[model samples]
Target chain A: MPMLRIEGLDHRWTGARQDTIRVGALALGAGENLFLHGPSGCGKSTLISAIAGVIDVAEGAVCVAGRDIGSLGSGARDRFRADHIGLVFQMFNLVPWLTGIENVILPCTFSRRRRRRAGNPEAVARRLLGDLGLDPDELGRKTAGDLSVGQQQRVAVARALIGTPDLILADEPTSALDADAKTAFLDVLMRDCKAANTALLFVSHDRGLEGHFDRSVDFRDLDRGGTR
Target chain B: MIGFSLRSLWNRRFVAGLTVFAIALSAALIVGVEKLRDGARDSFVNSASGIDLVVAPRGNPVQILMAAVFGIGGTGTAMSWESFEWLENMPGVAWAVPIQMGDNHRGYPVIGTDVTYFEHVRHSGGQPLQLASGTLFIEGQADGAVLGAEVAARFGHAPGTVIVNAHGSGDVSFHMHDDAPFTVTGVLAPSGTAIDRMVIVSLAGFDAIHAPHGTPDADPLDAAGLAVPPRNTRADHETHEEHREHTGHDHDEGSRAAAGTGEHAHPRGRDPDGHAHAPERLNAVYVGLADRTGVLGLQRAVNDRAAEPLSAVLPAVALTELWGITGTAERALQIMAWTVALASIIGMVVMLSATLESRRREFAILRSVGASPAHVVRLILTEAAVLTGAGLFLGIGIFILAARVAGPVLASRFGVQLDTRGFDARELAVLASLFGAGLAAALVPAIKVYRATLADGLSVRI
Candidate 1:
């Protein structure tokens, strides 16, 4: 079974009176990197919200780690996501008040399973940060708000991969970086994700990132043709 | 969780401090009022309990009580010598202590009374005045005076040291009886009463300083009745002339003993000639009734006196009335304090509410990181709890600091001893209620965070 399996997923925001997101089928096997791209205004945001269990899934199955998340309640889905899927958001979403390592340890604060899996979570975070080119002293020293864009992006990637979740969802995490830095950071992020044997779902409108992934797909290919 | 909350608040310490200060000021106000009210009432009840009645020229009872019992405000008017002589010798009158005030020594009011005052007056918990050192002034010992414990301790006045009297009851006086300086004969033990702030002198001491020319004017207010012996014929008497120039801090040793012979010459075994010069007036008098049941009859008799307009007030009744007057003022203060406290709670709510717009992204980001909506709600509530809890603690700190700085000054200056240690049950209840109310206010914003639609918050458009 694949690490993530999606089939016939349909979600509609009740107040908006339109289907914000609709998907027929998608799958990513263990350790497979899929580059999903689309221009602005193509329901990429809706898919991201749906994948994170933030919005309700009207119809379909979102199976992660072999368990269908659509069958779980709101709280359970949240717990399931925390335990299995690591989210790397678009804009380097590190909690500004925390130091870099503190931000990486945030997911473990929410999930006991991740805390147990990390085995001395601080040590693991330091090692993963070291792999992602953030020095040990810098991880413990600088605040997330004080770090440069490239440094903050690396820290965010380290946070998502900290507990080695089965699925890594990178939502345009490199969009803020310069072209040279983007290529360099993607190399480190892919190397770390492949080492952990985690499937990487990289979403970005810029197709330039496709070269770093094993396969790529346009987000509109999976959209259900309807009043979306 | 608390650590995280503190860090978040630390980022906004300046704004947080303003909130804490607002809460602190209101808390300190209520706390100080409660303390002062409790302390004042206790002291007033303690000192006024033993004295049954205060008989004086008819006036505002609160004013009379303030002037006579508390030695506050200005002096009261004098009644006739006939009234004092009459009341003392009355059937139900156990004893009467005449009190006269106009002169002050180093800011402490000087009250002139006979030794009967030392024998009759009682203070805190019904304790009588006891000499801490030296003896009570002998009647003929014109220069002898006694000091209250605080006056002696504060002014460093010891027996045999003479202190010049200022002409009025207030702290600063333009006129001083430098030639009529009274010798400090003794210091009274600390009675924790109003007397601790008084200077007790012989009634003769009171009259000598007020006498016009060393020839005792029995009633200066009614000079027409005093048959002044032709001035030169009474040249042997201590003339107020020799004392006139010695004003302010200057004093004349020769005039010190001369002033004592004016009127209240007590224990002075003087010739019948000296007794003839008795002062003809008295300020308020403390009259002790032989029987408690006879009080109403005596009060009615004093009030209905055909000879002079006089009124007698029961000490307890008058003091309670005073409390009623001040209680209104105190209640106003409490209402104002509580309003400030209400504003503080509202301020906390508004402060937290103001952050919701900006913090939405922080909340959404937490949700994306697998934090349930409930977690977001908890984070906001936790921040509120910490805010209020810190503010309450800060308020208590401000109160303790004030009491430490202000308690002793009040105790020494006003004879009001405040207990600053711990909260009484009522005070604790008030604090607890404030705590509850503060957290409840914080929940308004917490609930807002909980019910927030955070889906768009997590998604990036581009």
Candidate 2:
């Protein structure tokens, strides 16, 4: 079985009359890196949230690490997401009050599996941040709220790769960075996830970085195929 | 978790501070009311100690307590001397000490009782009577007096000085008996009781002055013909020549303390028992008891044997009833305390509820970082607990400080001591309830955050 599988995945926000998603089957092998690009309102963020088990699936199955999230309760889904998946949002989504190191260790606080996987989580987070060009002082500085946007993206990449999650969901992770910073961040992200055998679902509206990933899937094309 | 909560509060310190102050103000009102209620009870109990039954002419118990214990007026008719004697002789009676009020020496009330009073009367802690200076009245000398601590302090009277008494209650007097004055034979030590504000003369002495003396401004039937002249009249006379001549000779003669000699008495001796030189009618008696039980029985026994229409009461009962009468006002104050607490809790809820919306982004971040909804809920509750607990602690501290700073002033002004150490269980319960309600109030906002987090997914609203 692929590390993540989607079969006839469909969703709409609760209390809304219109369907926001109708996607055909898709599958990703372990350590696969895919670039998912689409126009605004094409449910790119919604598809990433589904893969991360953050949003409830209105129809079809979103299976991460081979377990269907649609079958899990809310609490179990939360725990499953914490243990098996690492997500990076368009913004860093780091707790503002926590230090950079503290924000990086937050996943480990909730998931013993993540903590175990990270192997002395602090040391792992420090090494990852250092490799991503964040100094020890930057790692100890207050969270994304205090960091520049480029720096925040680098921290988010390090955080996503910290626990070697089975699936890495990067939601517009490099949108705020310049081309050079984006290249540096992508190099660190792809290299780290590949080394840990983690599948990557990188979402962005920009197609400039499509060449960096193993496969490129247009969200509009996928939705068209699933609807037809 | 604590760090997070602290940072959240620090970020919105202004709103949080108002919530904290609201809780604190509520705490202050609740704690203050509790202290005042307890203090009033303590004052009533303290003032009513030692006296088992307050024998009086029939009236309200609270009124009787106000008059007898605190010296506030509304004189129930005096328990007649005959009634007092009868009560003292009752089967269950230990000692009946009549408190004869209605006369003033300086600003203090003049109480009349027999010499046996000194032997039997004990103060709150069972401390026996000790004279600060001089001796008790000579058993038969109706003209001798024992000055209360305040009276003694006011007049600078020692064992030998003859103080012209002020012979009535209120701020004015009707009669002036300049011809007679009692020799201050003793000064009592500070007693922290009504006695501290009394000039205790013999019942016979008080009686003598009130008798119909038939002389202008004098009661002729009174032994020794000694009546306290009105203060205004004395000031005028003292400003005149004849007063100087009288006072000069009297001062010298009284200062002569011929301790072992009765040799200075009148060269012509009159009737014995010194009825010729003693007062005719007693004011009231002071009762002392060997055992405190059967007080009601003793009261009944006294009333049945009385010649005049009179009533007997337990001073404690009367004082308790007086305090009970204030129960409605006290309850109203307690309700006010609760209302303040409720309002404060509502304020905290409103603030917390308002802030919860802003906290959605934080909650979403936390959830994306893997915090459970339960964890977020706990963080909110913890913040509430911290704020409410701090307010309660500070409120209690304020109460204790205010009571300590104002204790003596209140005692002197209202005769009620505000004891700082007497916090009751009820107050503790109120504080705990306030804290509990505050925490509960935070739950509304907490649930809202939980729902927002689930809906927002990995996306932080901010």
Candidate 3:
């Protein structure tokens, strides 16, 4: 069975009359890296948020590890997401008050399953950061707000790979980096995801990142043939 | 969780400082107001010490005490001299010192009493009156007087110095008793009593100056009063002395004697034919009881005297009753204080709520990092409590400084010393109540933070 299965997911904001999402089906096996390309206003961020269990779907079910996520309560969905899914946003959304290592190890605090799978959560964060060429001192010394753009992007990748979550959702995570930094970030992020046996769903507006992934889905074709 | 919350607050120190300052200022005002109430009450209570029973002609006891103890009213009637003697001779009578007002010497009241007043009266803290300078008057020396500390100090006078009385309350007087000038034989210690600015003289001095100028033997038939004792003989009596330099004027003995002696003195002491004297009556007397246990009994005895109408009062009870009549004013003050406190709490609430608008992003970021909505709520509440607690400490510190600085001055002026160490349970309860109210104010904003964070859900809202 695939690690994630989505079928006929649909949504609209509670107050809005128009549907924002209408997707037929999608599936990702363990250890697969899929690149999703779309421009602004194509609901790329919205889809990622929905898959992370942060937003409720208006129709159909999203299954993770063969369990239907649609029937779970809000708190249960949050717990499920925290346990099996690690999400990284385009802006490297780390709490500004927490140090780099502390931000990387956060999923383990909310999910015991992730914590157990990582063997030792703090060590896993440190090793991943070290592999990504982040300074060891930078792990403990710098808060997320204090780090540069490249450093922040690398930290976000490290965070998503920690705890060995079955799925890693990266939403335009390398968009802020220069080409050299982007290439370096992709190398470590893809390599770490493969080693952890986690499926990567990478979303970005940039087409150049497509070849690095095993599969590519253009979001424009998935949404009413919308194009950017 | 605490670490994160603290770090977040640290990053927003400007906002935190403003919130903390507001809390501190409100706390200071609330505590300061309460302290002032206690201080004023303490001063009042202290002034009432050692005064047991106060006897006055039948009327309001509150009025009598307000006038006598507080220097706050017009003269009531005086008890008859016979009645005064009767009370003083009673078994429980310690000393009955009369307070004669209605006369002023340069705005200071002239109190006519015996020397026993200075010897026996005890003030707050069991302190006795100590003479500042000179000596108390001899028992029968009607012309000798004691100056209140300020009066003597003001005029640069000691024993053997004389000051003329102006014969009335205000500085304006149609008549002056220049011939019967008061010689300062003593000066009283600073008692913070009505006596502090008084001119204390023997009771006999008041009688002598006020003695009516008429012969006791005068009959109705001797209508015109036997030719006015010869205009030439009065001329000689006036012309016998050389002129002495006086304060704003130069005057001789004739003007002095004419000004001092009023025509009614002779009629009060004698008939027109010039026989011996007769005793006139007094209106009231102040009686001090030796055993306060017997005040009621002594009052009853004094009231039973069939010879005259009178009333004896316990000064403390009378004062309490007097103050009770002005309960409206006291309530008004309390309401004002309460309004000020309420406004302060509302200010804190508004300030905290307003700042929450800017902090929504911080809360959203926190939510993204696995902090529950409840955690955000706790963080806000803790920040408020910290501000209020710091402010409370600052306010109390200011109060202590005030007490230390102002307490003694008030004590010496009012005969009542505040005990600075006397912070009772009531004060502590009031402080705790303010803190609780402040925490409640903070909770309102924290709840808003919780709701906004929940709505955003792992995404930055602002």
Maximum-lDDT candidate: 1
Ranking by TM-score: 1, 2, 3
**Model 3 misplacement above 4 A:** A1-10, A22-34, A51-53, A56-87, A92-147, A154-168, A191-201, A214-228, B1-6, B57-59, B72-74, B90-97, B100-311, B322-327, B402-422
DockQ of 1: 0.46
TM-score per candidate, chains pooled: 0.81, 0.79, 0.70
- Per-residue alpha-carbon lDDT of model 3 for B1-462, expressed as tens digits? 555556766776776666666656665555656666565555445445677776777767776665555444544555554566667688988876665555567766676666666765565545777788888887646678998776777678788998777555565666566656779998887765555667877665654455322324344323332234311244323322211122123334344443224222222233222211111334335566778899888878766778876677787777577567656665676666556656766766776688677667666555554456776788888777776676677667756776678755554344334444646787788778878988887888888887887777766656
Q: CA shift at A109, candidate 2, in angstroms?
A: 2.8
Instruction: Give the winner by DockQ: 1 or 2.
Output: 2
Q: In Å, what is the interface RMSD of model 2? A: 1.8
With a 3 Å backbone cut-off (N, CA, C), the pairs that clash in candidate 1 are B139-B266, B139-B267, B140-B268, B204-B264, B213-B240, B214-B240
Candidate 3 has an lDDT of 0.67
For candidate 2, what is the DockQ-based docking class?
medium
Best by TM-score: 1
DockQ of each: 0.46, 0.58, 0.26
State, as a TM-score between 0 and 1, how close model 1 is to the true structure. Answer: 0.81
Task: Please provide, for model 1 over B276-296, each residue's C-alpha lDDT reduced to its tens digit, 9 standing for 90 to 100.
Answer: 223445668889988888998
Measured over the true interface residues after superposition, the C-alpha RMSD of each candidate is 1.5, 1.8, 2.7
